[model samples]
Target: MSKTPKYFIVEAGALPEIFLKVAEAKRMLETGEVDTVHLATKRAGISRSAFYKYKDAVRPFNDMLQGRIVTFQILLKDEPGVLSSVLNIFARSGGNILTINQAIPANGCAAVTIGAETSGLEVSMEELLSRALSVEGVVRCEILAG
Candidate 1:
């Protein structure tokens, strides 16, 4: 009988060099940088056997997030255009806005939650969150769900 595969999110620095090279080979092929697996493996400095062994198992973090819906909860100062500024960040990042909820301001701050489709996003979730936090009047942001 075959065993089911289990996965873990290890930091890039901790991964074996061969695994990283395999992932790079895959990227090269996907991006049309190389026309064939042999070329990709050669460019990435990995043997064809190693590339084939790990290519299916390794993927970039953003590629994993593609096609998923992500929700974020944000705290913002109740100032003019703060919400607009937040939405603009998502738009600029290629996130497809799905829904937005905002509570009435209480004590000079408001809570907002945004849901966005990430399939077409130009940036990763971490980058999106960073951009949101950097917006003027944004107090804090966190992933509510995904």
Candidate 2:
């Protein structure tokens, strides 16, 4: 018998490095020390391109009620922001990312495996499918739910 998948929620522009700084900036801003991106980036030693690359792609983790999770194996084109775009869908769909594994391209495409919890998805699986399919460089999206 197969199990269901868990999901998480993330921003559309968030990336790994940017995600860390954004979290830090949120805390710093709370202390009223810095409220601008310039200050935050300066303090964090992150470039603006890196910040903008993943500004909206960050998200908090979430686990499914059924305690199930899905592993999405994606084939992405070799280009900038392609991986981020793919992650954005999962983030926007409330896919709590547990881990992301990628490999070097073999045929102008890279394989990425993302483990996420599908606990509190705002949209249906069909919608998620549509979104993933709509990405610019996504060659394939294989959902491995078990």
Candidate 3:
């Protein structure tokens, strides 16, 4: 019999609330304020069982992060050639966009997200994100490594 490999959760920074809770719990434990794991979980409003389950599993963003990333959802302006421009930026950044999805603009803007991998190229997530955000007509660009 063979066992499947384990995976870690490394995108907590994108989720501010959960990230903060874990951080606070760590702080409490380090300072010896909570005393017991059960008390710490109660104070943090998280179940003791859940605390144990996710304690070692949860990690801060950019900490021990590793994955072949794909699929990003970008919110853009409803303007001429805005999407093309966005693609151009991705190309320049070495992202081989595999798929894109857009919704009908309801409030004078649209959203586009491209799924690409690092391929043979190597780059930090921060660099990739900065480049995406610098593109014109892009209201926001989020890199999701799922």
Best by lDDT: 1
Q: Write the residue-wise lDDT of candidate 3 on 1-146 in tens digits.
A: 99886875555556657546766676588679988887787788777776776677565443343345566788988999888887876677666777888889869888776777655234555676777677777889886554
> Tens-digit lDDT track for model 2 on 1-146?
99774545544355455677766654455567888777876787777677667555543332122245778788999899999988888888877789999999988999988887776667755577679978999998876663
Give the Å shift of residue 8 in candidate 2. Answer: 26
Tens-digit lDDT track of model 1 for 1-146: 99999877777899999888888888889989999999998999989998877788998766776899988899999999999999999999999999999999999999999998999888778899899999989999987776
Worst 10 residues of 1 by lDDT: 58-67
> Candidate 1's C-alpha lDDT?
0.89
TM-score of each: 0.77, 0.53, 0.53
Model 3's TM-score against the true structure? 0.53
For every model shown, the clashing-pair count is: 0, 22, 3
Q: RMSD of each candidate?
A: 2.8, 15.7, 9.0
Order by TM-score, highest first: 1, 2, 3
**Candidate 3: regions farther than 4 A off:** 1-67
Error of 3 at 10 (Å): 7.2
Winning candidate number (TM-score): 1
1 against 2, candidate with superior lDDT: 1
